[model samples]
Target chain A: MMSMHTKNINTHLVEIKDYFKVAISVDCVIFGFNDDELKVLLIESDLKEFKGKWSLLGDIVRPDEELDEAAYRVLKERTGLDDVYMEQVQTFGAIHRHPAGRVITVAYYSLVNIEHVELKLHNNELHWHSVKDLHEMAFDHKQILDTCHERLKQQVLVQPIGFNLLPRKFSLRELQNLYEAILDMELDRRNFRKKFLSMDLLMDLNEEEEDVPHRPAKLYKFNFDKYDQRKKRYLGIGF
Target chain B: MMSMHTKNINTHLVEIKDYFKVAISVDCVIFGFNDDELKVLLIESDLKEFKGKWSLLGDIVRPDEELDEAAYRVLKERTGLDDVYMEQVQTFGAIHRHPAGRVITVAYYSLVNIEHVELKLHNNELHWHSVKDLHEMAFDHKQILDTCHERLKQQVLVQPIGFNLLPRKFSLRELQNLYEAILDMELDRRNFRKKFLSMDLLMDLNEEEEDVPHRPAKLYKFNFDKYDQRKKRYLGIGF
Candidate 1:
């Protein structure tokens, strides 16, 4: 499966290579979750300028590709995954941002159910590290990561995008903890429970946590259909 | 004065032009204010490909220049004005968004304080039609304008950017009219006034509307110092 996908991708690259000079590239901020911490995917820079340094998953713009397509292509090339929940965040363009010369990058953020993508073939050096422990990254990547992190925190409050980062069946306690990690604030458990329940967007999956010695809690799946309907009337006015 | 400013601007442009392709282009959402009605700026296209059509003012980026500086240069070149309040909004590049080849455009919106701009310089072709009355514009200008208009409406609620579109001294009623026009909703006059007063970002000028025959309203200017402080706090929210 991986070899066939790689061959298919190489074909697309050949087609793009023969077309017009592409001026746009997409950089992804793939956030993952584990051990009650928020983490992001990173790779060691293979370029001579930044060898041995960690960098965001990125690539050059293909001659005939749309910016978003390039972002998806780079993601697939590096991680061998598709259909992840992604959104365009911002474009960063300081004249001297790139050592290769003037390359403006469009940044995107994606949330993946980490367990689903853990088996994918990625760059040999690719790894996920806790956002809290991230250090200097190659080619302005640290700035890009910071910007994406800010957007993630803001979006989590107003959108149900956080679900994309978690398993389909999750305990309310686990969900609350995810929020605390992303927001970096200790939410009052009782108040947080009250607010989320009142929204009525969660479905009681009738499933409970397993393999734990302590008492397991009930699990829920986000009811996306109702969320969409409510979203139509949503004015983006809430936190 | 015009020659001196132009010379200074040229020097500044020259210093950065080597690092970038400085293409002067304009992305104007000509906003119209008619009887409390809001609108945008547009132009009739001259290209055979999109002849007889309206579109946003835009063109190729020149060699070596800052994106924001280029945006203003394009605005000034097309409108014969400087010192206008313009902002870099977004960069649009959906491969098929432009039919005239793969041109990546950085979008910008300018608030002209309509009364200050004569509008006689656009070869008598530029139009400021109502936002409600707008039809199909050339290229992807309609989409660009819609995006900028949305940003403008959001900013109005949180920032004092509306002042850039109003006269130097404006009445509270006129200010409310501008908001109602852009937001497409009627606001309770008393409540709107109360909100503005509480913000304390406006300075009463001890002057009144001069030309109206009926009872005149007092004038006020936006307080820049207070605005600067509020702006710093507003930027902290991670917009």
Candidate 2:
């Protein structure tokens, strides 16, 4: 019975069993855009201790799941959408971060186009909360949200990941609004348009906004292929 | 027998115990500068299966320790130094990454001034390997190393963390050499010096290199306070 493979298995069993007291979980700060405001999906906590408090949609990761898979699964199960862009932001492992003994959670922020996906809130508790209006949340989830939001703000300027929050065909005005909502700062309109156009990563689709009170702007789609190639060249150089 | 606190504890215990099969660890990619080359501290694997292969300096995170605390402990235990500039780069949690079990590791890279620390290797197996010369590493360490290296390269251009790898007072030439080594490309000396000086983050010590084969270059030190304030202003804006 003590073959090479068997020996390896035994060594793993003994070493792993002793360290199994620590549990791993994943928390997702899923950002969605609706009506020119940045929103995050949250659920009212079912735990009695956190009754009526909002919390990031999360679950204890199963033994068989990859960290990213667990996060994507949480997103899919909550929103009924797949193929959303998600990035792991950070791992939070304060010793008492969890009320349930020694649970460490990895935080991921995902961007989904709100108008594109039909959410299937399984418990009917999930709702999109405006990022600016968020109050205290359950179990250090507020800290997690802040961290992911900071990351999102940082990433939007450099990477084209912000496109995930917008519809496929979006006007320049809508793009500027998205940035303003995420950054919480007003950007010079002319400067913003000039900067983005100079990057050469947007395609003029010859389309205009469907409905608007004022003059509708020309529509453009992110040229992902060009962005991908340009991004590779910009790596290691900041901005 | 169960008060409110005890009842909460019991609930946590039951929920957490079911997910205890996952083990967590912290891996430190300790980057150090040696002889104008960017180097990483690695140790020879103790496992018989990986004999002679280099591994990141790491250990299983103890149940009582925070994730960051565990990374710092590994760095201190391995290098015999504290207060080094450390940052968590990313977490790797691929299933089967560890042959022993499903071990998820958070990777951190610490910049240590090699000349400042008296490294007590504990065993002769520990060595500083030039990053460019590293071959296959034990476990998934090569990928981990690459990821951390990429993060370090990206960070040096935007932040003052690279100062942690150099002496307190260094000539512009030394600083450029450090950048060239980390970036693996030759930078124009005059251009590099001009760019850094333009930031106004460096303070001229009015000192020269003490021992040099050629004429000693004028020395300067990074102005930490100015860099800290400047960094906040630069946030959300790409380099």
Interface RMSD in angstroms for candidate 1? 16.2
Would you estimate the TM-scores of all the predictions? 0.77, 0.91
lDDT (10s digit) by residue, model 2, range B134-216: 97988889999999998888788767788899999998888988999898889877778778888787899988998799999
- Highest-lDDT candidate: 2
Q: What's the C-alpha lDDT at position A215 in model 1?
A: 100
Per-residue accuracy of model 1 over B1-239 as CA lDDT, tens digit each: 33322221101222322223211223555454646667566666655556777777654443365567666655665556678777766677765555444556778888877666665336325667788676687777778888888778766775677788788898998888998887767788888888788878789999999888779999999897876765343121211
lDDT of 1 by residue, A75-187 (tens): 67555677898887777666666655566777888888778775333443678889989889877788989989987886786578898989989888988889888887777
DockQ of each: 0.09, 0.31
DockQ of 2: 0.31
